[model samples]
Target: MEQHNRFWRIALLSLPLGVFGLFVIWPLFSSFYYSFTDWNGFDANYSYVGFDNFAKIATDRLFLQAAVNTTIWMIAAIVLPTALGLMLALLLDSRVAGARVFKSIFYLPICLSAVIVGQIWTWIYQPDWGLLNTVITQVTGEKFKYAWLAKPDTALWSVIVAWSWQQTGLSMVIYLAGLTAIPGDLLEVCEIEGASPWQRFRRVVLPLLAPSTVVVVALSVINSLKGFDILYIMTGGGPFNSSDTLAMHMYNESFKKYLMGYGSAISVVLFLIALAIIGLYFRQLRKVDRIYG
Candidate 1:
């Protein structure tokens, strides 16, 4: 009976495993292989370039801009969502009317696909009659028609705002779970001891939330790296490539420009960056565990 179950288990896993290998693992290896070649993504003929692509990366001004934009993207993505979520979690976790309904409303975005979220925000940001502009016009008593997505200066920030809106709920839910795990008795003690709200939050509540913060930050990091689809839909790295992140740049180079080899090199760099960040995060997590545990 045990052998029969084991065979069934392997059989059940085999298809998904095979599929994963074919799609994900194969593409990853292909990217690495092509990174060292001058393959234009078509034509059987190509040459081994051996770090030539990497050399070009050093002097490519657009690459430098993309790198800078990526850094800003990651930083803003991590900070905005995490901070706003924590605030919302704190607000909604308290005894307020319709808290449950509010939580559900906030979390609705996470259930929607990225495409849907992108579309919703795109409409909200429309220049002429969009919700945001309309509100601004009403408040300022002027006809506001500034194109949020088309303007180079504001495009990246506008998308960042939309991203924060979608991601904040996930962080909030995680933080709420963390808050619940804190002992009510400890909080009661603080209150009885006449500890101010800020003091209790700083000296007790915040430290207890360390685990949740770690998880939220890590998710923000990974999600920010993969936050290309919405940008693609919204701006396509437009207005002189001001909003072009590393991933967007990679896509443009690989597919649009048909510079597959150079794009592969960018992908490799991005992969290394993501790997290093995750590694460092896990290392710090271990240290935190040792100290806290």
Candidate 2:
């Protein structure tokens, strides 16, 4: 009976492992294999070109531009949403009146799909009649009309603004959870010692929230790296690929341009980059834990 139970347990675990191997693991290795080829995604005339795709990606001017834009997006995604979220969390956690209502209002954006948010922001960014420009002109009493997402200079930043709008709510919720987990006794002790509000927060609240901060930062970094739907809907990597993120670039190369091999190479690079970021995040997290242990 014990052997029978052990056999059943092995069988149950093997099912998921087998499925993952078939679906996820197989595709990852296959993508690496295809990255070295010149396949057009379909056809019997495919040939392995031996690192030519990676070589091309290394030298491609447009790919380099996309990398820079992605980096900017990553930074903005990390900084802006985090700052806004922390602010909101601190305010709401103070037990202010109508705080729940404000929290709900802020979090509503997170429930909306990224594509829907992109469409709404697209209308807001319209040149002459858009809400943003219209409000700017009204407030400043000067005609200031420009295509927000069309210009190369403002394209990436515009998308980042929209992305941050949705992401801030998520960050706020995470920080709120962290804030609530903090021991009330610690705050009371700080107050008893006549510690200033800023000092208490800086010394007690922030340090205790390290785990939550690590999770939020890691999630934000990964999401920023994989940003696609919003960019796809808003700019379609348009205006001379000004808003092209790595994910969008990969999609365009694979489906639109029919360079499946090169697209696979791009995907591989993205995967490696994500892995490196995650690895670094864990390393820092371990160091922080040691210092605070």
lDDT of 2 by residue, 1-293 (tens): 99999999998989899999999999999999999999997797899899999999989988998999889988887798888998899999999999999999999999999999999999999998999999999999999898999998888889899999999999999999989988789899999999999999898898888877887887788899988999998898878999998999999999999999999999999989998999989997898779866
Task: Estimate every model's Cα lDDT from 0 to 1.
Answer: 0.92, 0.91
The digit string of per-residue lDDT tens for model 1 on 1-293 reads 99999999999999999999999999998989999998998889999999999999999999999999889988997799999999999998786899999999988999988778889999999998999999999999999999999999999998888888999999999999999988899999999999999999999999988988988998898888888988998888877999999999999999999999999999999999999889978987887688777
Q: Which ten residues in a row have the lowest lDDT in candidate 2?
A: 210-219
- Scored by lDDT, model 1 comes in at 0.92
- The regions of model 1 sitting more than 4 angstroms off are 1-17
Model 1, residue 209: displacement in angstroms?
A: 0.5
Best-fitting candidate, measured by TM-score? 2
Question: Which lDDT value does model 1 have at 203?
Answer: 97
| Every model's TM-score | 0.93, 0.95
Q: Give the Cα error of residue 141 in candidate 2, in Å.
A: 1.3
